[model samples]
Target: MFTTIHRWGNSQAVRLPKGILETASLRENDRVEITAEYDRIIIRKATKKHLTIEERFEGYNGDYRCKEADTGGPVGNEEW
Candidate 1:
């Protein structure tokens, strides 16, 4: 679809159509890439950033599972 760039005070802006945004599954404030081709400009969604192990640990509480050791000796051992 063709869109026009209009003047916005000192900078320029483009009014993206709702249908186009919906078809692309884009949300407000989402990251986008603008590529300048020889004749036209291409806008595409940027790849999502993957979280690392350290990043995933941020604000994480210490919740873990542990097995208790057997207090008694061998099960087949004779009692004194």
Candidate 2:
């Protein structure tokens, strides 16, 4: 449960254990929010910006028509 902080290029980094990362639900390249609370360092998973249904459909501007054409309006007694 102990690790030594080392310098990575220009910044210092601490290698987290796989168990700790799994417990925290973290993965490689995942973003984290780091903050200093008085004397303690808090590291939390950053909230992902997920697009809603409306937002996903925002780019669509035209009506999507099917390939099949209507069969000349209903002629038989098709029960409205």
Candidate 3:
């Protein structure tokens, strides 16, 4: 399979075929890491890091209070 590199605005872009994407388990809007090694370009899916709840709120001072907000009443067919 072959593809042509086209000028997209200010950068060069290559359109990967559907088969290639499927083989790599890649989807549209997926994050990828691109690197150039010698004369070849490599593309790989970016790994996501999962943070625990404690890690996510490492610097919190616990000063938040939950409040009920008035939504101007229900408009359509609400059982409330």
Winning model by TM-score: 3
| Cα deviation of 66, candidate 1, in Å | 43
Q: Which 10-residue window of candidate 3 scores lowest in summed lDDT? A: 71-80
* Candidate 1 local lDDT, 1-80, one digit each (tens): 78889999999999989998999999899888889999977888988676799998998789877889878875665655
Point out the higher-scoring one by TM-score: 1 or 2. Answer: 2
Flag regions of model 3 displaced more than 4 Å.
Answer: 49-80
- Tens-digit lDDT string for candidate 3 (1-80): 98999999999999999999999999999888899999999999989666799999999998999999887877889758
Indicate the worst ten consecutive residues by lDDT in candidate 2.
Answer: 70-79
Return the candidate ranking by TM-score, descending: 3, 2, 1
Report RMSD for candidate 2: 15.4
Native-to-model Cα distance after best TM-score fit, residue 8 in candidate 1, in Å: 1.6
What TM-score would you give candidate 2 relative to the actual structure?
0.57
Q: Mind giving the per-residue lDDT tens digits that candidate 2 earns over 1-80?
A: 78998999999999999999999999998888899999877888998666789988997988898798777766669747
Local distance difference test, candidate 1: 0.87
Clashing pairs in 3: none
The candidate, 2 or 3, that scores higher on lDDT is 3
